[model samples]
Target: MIVIGIDPGIARVGYGVIEKQERLIRPLCYGCIETSSHERTTSHRLHEIYTRIQVLFAEHSPDEIAVEELFFTKNVTSAIRVAEVRGVILLAAEERGVEVVEYTPNQIKLAVSGSGRAKKEQVQDMVRRLLKLEEIPRPDDAADGLAIALCHINTLR
Candidate 1:
């Protein structure tokens, strides 16, 4: 089965693609989609994210999309923007007829690192080990995206 994981944000949205073949879970691709904060309006940025993700769905044909749910942040404005981008991601999945699953930050950390209270480095290291990567996925957001997918695949197991 193929799954794509998303870590949503206003300036950058991270994505990771993975496949479960037999007993092994492998990473296919991982990266971030970035939008400039200077030239675009928030709505335009959301549309661009939505469009790019739709292209990803077409290219990957993933069976499911695993997304990290919003966590409370002290910055209300930033949190709200993240939420909006997240909604756009979910809408893209729905339009592509892919099933969507959500995981909280704690749940993702637990599933990926064996501890809900695991630090970011721990989770990233676990993701590298689990996916058999040579190094931790670049750009912390992308690593978090992989963690989200790994979380879903582990849950299935």
Candidate 2:
């Protein structure tokens, strides 16, 4: 099974693809979609996000998509923007007929690091260890995306 995991944000949306087979999970791809901060238009940024995700769906051909659910302690504005990005990702997946699953940040952290309250570095380290990668993915968002994918893979077992 191939799964695409998303960590949504208005400025930079992160995505990771994983292929699972017979108890093995392999990283297929991981990256962030960055929008221009100087563009002076939120709509343009949103359009860029939508278009990029659409292209990613086509390129990866994932059977399913797993995305992190919003968990905001504060900053309602940030949460709303992230939610909008998440909606765009879901729309793209739905249009392509891909199954969508949502997971919380704590759920992903626990699945990846065996602790719900694990630090970001811990989750990233475990992701590298489990995937047998030599280095952790950069910019934090990519690692979070991979963690989301790992959570889904672990849950299926």
Candidate 3:
């Protein structure tokens, strides 16, 4: 099975793809989709995100998508921006007829690091360890995407 996990953001939407066998899970790809502020408007940026995600769906043909649930933010503006990005991502998955699973930050840490209260560093380390990667995934958000995917995959076991 192939699963794509996402960490949504207006400027950089992070993604990680993983392949799962009966008892193995390995990273296939990981990166971020960047939309510059130079874009004409928020709608334009959103359009870019939507289209890029569609392309991703086409390229990966993932059986399922996993996205981190939006957590509470002190900055309402930041929260709204992330929400907009997330909306497009979910919509893309829906249109492609792919099932999506959502996991909270804590749930992801628990699954990836065996502790709901694990630190970000610990979770990132665990993500690298679990995937048997030589180093932690880059661009922070990409690692976040992996952690989110790991959470869902572990739950299925």
Candidate 4:
């Protein structure tokens, strides 16, 4: 089965694609969709994310999409913007006929690192070890995407 994990945000939306067979998990691709502040409006940025995510779905044709649930944020404006971006992501998945699964940050950490309060670096390290990668995935957000996907895969087992 193929799974795509997402760490959604307005300025940067991270993604990772993985293939699972039996007990083996393989990373297919990992990256981020970024929008510059120079963009005209939040709507335009969201449009970009929506378009890119649709293209990704077309290319990967994932069986399921695993997304990180929104956590509490001190900044209300940022939280709202992230929520909007996440909505666009869900819409893209729905349009593509992909199943969507949401996992909270704590759930992800617990699944990935055996602890709900694992540090960022600790989680990243575990992702690297689990995937047998030479090094940690670049750009923290991309690693986070991989973590989310891996968390879901583990939960299923």
| Top-TM-score candidate index | 4
**Residue pairs with clashing backbones, model 4:** none
Candidates' TM-scores?
Answer: 0.97, 0.97, 0.97, 0.98
For 1-157, candidate 2 gives per-residue lDDT tens digits of: 9998899999889888999989778999998999977945877888899999999999989988999999897999989999888888888888999999999989999989999999999999998999888999987898888889989999989
Cα shift from native, residue 58, model 3 (Å): 0.7
> 3 or 4: which has the higher lDDT?
4
Q: Report the lDDT of model 1 for residue 132.
A: 93
What are the Cα lDDT values of the candidates?
0.93, 0.90, 0.91, 0.95
Candidate 3 lDDT, tens digit per residue, 44-142? Answer: 999999999999889989999999999876989889999999899989999999999999999999999999999999999999999999999988999
For model 4, the stretches where C-alpha displacement exceeds 4 angstroms are none
> Which runs in model 3 stand beyond 4 Å of their true positions?
none
Error of 4 at 133 (Å): 0.6
| Model 4 lDDT per residue over 8-127, tens place | 999999899999999889999999999987936999999999999999999999999999999866999999999999999999999988999999999999999999999999999999
- Please give the clash total of every predicted structure, in order: 0, 0, 0, 0
Q: Is candidate 2 or candidate 3 better by lDDT?
A: 3
lDDT of 3 at 5: 89
lDDT of 4 at 25: 98
lDDT tens per residue, model 1, 1-157: 9999999999989889999998978899999999988978999999999999999899999999999999867999999999999998888888888899999999999999999999999999999999999999989999999999999999999
